[model samples]
Target: MSLLNLAWHSLWARRGTALLSLLTIALSVALLLGVENLRTQAKSSFASTISGTDLIVGARSGPTQLLLYSVFRIGNATNNISWDSYQQITQQPTVKWAIPISLGDSHRGYRVMGTTNSFFEHYQYANKQPLRFAQGRALENTYDVVLGAEVARKLQYHLGDKIVVAHGLAAVSFVNHEHYPFVVSGILQPTGTPVDRSVITSLAGIEAIHLPPQQQAYSEQQLTPSSITAMMLGTQSKLQIFSLQRQINEYKGEALLAILPGVALQELWGILSIAESALLAVSICVVITGLMSMLSTLMVSLKERRREMAILRSVGAKPRHIFGLLLLEALLLSVLGALLGLLSMYLILAAAKPLLLSQFGFYLVLTWPSLQQLYLLLAVVIVGFIAGVLPAWRAYRYSLSDGMSIRI
Candidate 1:
C-alpha cells in the first residue's frame, strides 16, 4: 500500500481512540488560536482608532480616563471645558484645526456628540484614515444629525428620519429634548471605532438644544444650544503640542486639563492590560489541559496496539517501518484536526461580524492570518510532531523484540 493509504488505515484501525484524541487536539487548537486572534485584533483596533492626532485636550484627570472618555466613550467626562477656552486655544498660530465635542446625550444607548464640521474633515481613524459618508454630507444646520454606521444599523435609522434626543445618556430616557428634534442628514461609513456607534451633530446644534436656565421660561422656544462636554484640538506643529498643553493646563480662567492623545491611549491600554492578560492566561490553561488530554489518550491506546506491532514484526517488518507507521498516523490526525478547527473559527467569526460591528464598532476583519498567527500555527505543528514521537518510539522497541514467531 502507498504510505498515505497505510497511514489512513492505521488511524482507522483504532478509530474510537483516535477520533477522541483528534477532537481533543482540535478543541485545544481552536481555543488557542481564537483567543490569540481576538487579543491581537483588540489591541490593534484600540490603538489605531485615533491616528495622526497630536494630543487630546480635556479636563484635568488621569490620562487613561481622558482617553477613555474622549476617544472610546467608555466613561463620562469628569468636567466640561468652557467654550471661551476652546476658542482661545484654536486661535494659536501653532493650532491647525480643532473639533469641539459635547456629550451627555443619547439616542437609545448610543452616545450623542456635538462637534464642528471640521470633525468630518479632520478626524481620522484606523491609521489616519479620514471619515467617509455612506449617504449625504456632514451635519450643518442646528437640527441636522449624522449617524455612525453602527448607530444607523442597530437603531434602523434612515436619512431624513427625525429622532428625539434624551437629556442624559440613558437607554430608556424619560427627560427628553422635546423641543429640538434631529433630522438624520447623513450616515458615516464603518470606521471600526467608537464613532461608528455614535450620533454626530454640530457644536451649534448642541448649543441650541440645551438652552440657559432662563430660556426654560419660553419652554416653547426653538432649539438654542449652549454648553458642551469636551473639545479635540489639532496643532500645526508637532513640537508645539507640549507648550499648548501647558498653556491649557495653566489657564487661570477656568479649571481645565489638556492631555496628549497618544500618551492617554497608552495609559488606557495599560490599565486595561491586567484584565486582558488574565483572560488570556485562563484560555492558555484550558488549551494546555486539552493538549494533555490528547497526549494521554494517544499514549494509552498504545497498549491495545502492542499485539498488532508484534504481528507486524513476525511478518518481518523492520523496526523503522513500524515506527514510521505510528508517526504517520499522528501527523495525519493533527493536520486534519487543525484544518477543521480553523474552518470552524472562520465560520463563527463571519456570523458574528455584523453584530459586533454595529454594537461596539469593533470590526473583525476576515483576512488571512498575520505573521504572528502563522508562527503560532507552526508551533502547533511542531508540538504535534513531538507528541507522536513517544508512540513511534514504543512501536520501534516492540518491533526490535518480536522476531517472526511471536503472536502475543
Candidate 2:
C-alpha cells in the first residue's frame, strides 16, 4: 500500500480517539474566529452609527462624554444651550440645517428625544441612508409622538396609543406626566443604530409635557423653547466644518463645544481596542491548548501502532516513511477541525443575529472569513505539523526488534 493509503487506514483504526481531538480543536477555532468577527463588525457598526452630519454641538464638556450622551444615549448632558444660540448658528450662511435635540425624559425605560422634523429629514446613517418610516408619519402636532423600531417592539405599542412621559431618564420613575399623555403618530424603521432605541417627539411636545397644566393648553408657536440639549449641524460645504466648529466653540454668549463625529468616534474606539486585544489573546491561548491536546492524543496512539510500523518496515518501508505518515495524519486532523470551526461559527451567528438586533440594536452582518481568519487556519496547520514532530521522531527511532518481539 502507498504511504497516503497507509496513513489513512492507520487514522481510521483510531477514529474514536481522533474524533474527540478533532472536536476539541474545532471548538477552540470556532471561539477564536467568533471573537475576531464580532470585534471587526462591532467597530464598524459603532463608527457608522451617526453619519452625514458634520459636527455635534453640545454643552462644553469632554469630547468622549459629549459623544456618549449625544450619539450613544448613554448619559445626560452637562448643560443645555440657549435656543437663541441655536437660532444664531442655524441662520449662518455656511449652515445648511440644524436639528435641535432636547433630552431629559423617558418612556418606559427608553429615552424620549425632542427634536424638529429636520431630524427625520436630514439625519443619515450607514453612508447617508435616509430614515424610513415603518408605519405612520412624522410628528404633525405637538402631542403626536414618534416611536423607534425597538421602542415600539419592546413596549408592544402601536400608532394612536396613548403613552405618558416621565420626568427623568430612568426605567422606573415616580414622576410621570399623566395629564399630558402623547399619542404615538409614527414608528421609525430599524437602522441598527441608537435611533432604533429612542422615542421621538416635537420640541413643542417636550416643552408642553413639562409645563404646568394651565400652560399645556398654549399653542406650539406660543410656547417658545428656552434651551436645547444639543444640535446636529449640517454645513453647506465640507471645508467650512472646521470654521463653523471653531466659531461655535468661541461663541461669547454661552458655553458650547463642537466636535467632529468621526474624530470623537476614533478616540472612543482607541480606548476600546485594549479590550479587543485581550479577547484575542485569550482566544489564542485556547487554540494552543487545543493543539496540545491533539498532540497528546497522537503521542499516546504511537505506542499501540508500533507493531504495525514493524510490519511495514519488514516490507521495506523506510523510517522516514513512518515519520511522514504520522505528520500527515496530524495535518489532516487540523485541516478538518479548521473547516468545521468555520461552519460552526457561521451557524451560531445566524441564529443570534435577530436577538442581538432586538435587544441591543446591533446588526451583525454575515460574511465569508476575512484574510486574517485564513491566516489563522494556515497557522493551525503549521502548528499541527510541528506538534507531530515529537511522535514522528519516536516512531523513526524505533528498531525493528522493538515492535517485532511479543514480550510475555
TM-scores for every predicted model:
0.90, 0.96
**Model 2 CA lDDT for position 222:** 57
Model 2 gets an lDDT of 0.90
Model 2 spans with C-alpha error above 4 angstroms = 219-222, 399-408
Model 2 per-residue lDDT tens digits across residues 288-320: 999999999988977777887887777778888
Candidate No. with top TM-score: 2
lDDT of 1 by residue, 1-408 (tens): 765687898878778877887777777767767777887899999889898777777777777777878888879877887767777777889889888888888888888988878889899987789999999888777789999998898889999999988878779989888788899999999888998988998766766667753464432224433445667778888888899889888988777788877777777788889998898788667656655666676678776677777777666667888888877887787777777667766777788887877655778888887787667666666677677888789778766765554445
Q: For model 1, what is the error of residue 66's alpha carbon versus the real structure, in angstroms, after optimal superposition?
A: 0.8
Positional deviation of residue 350's Cα in model 1 after best superposition, in angstroms: 1.6
Model 2 clash pairs are none
Top model number, lDDT: 2
Q: In candidate 2, how many Å is residue 347 off? A: 1.3
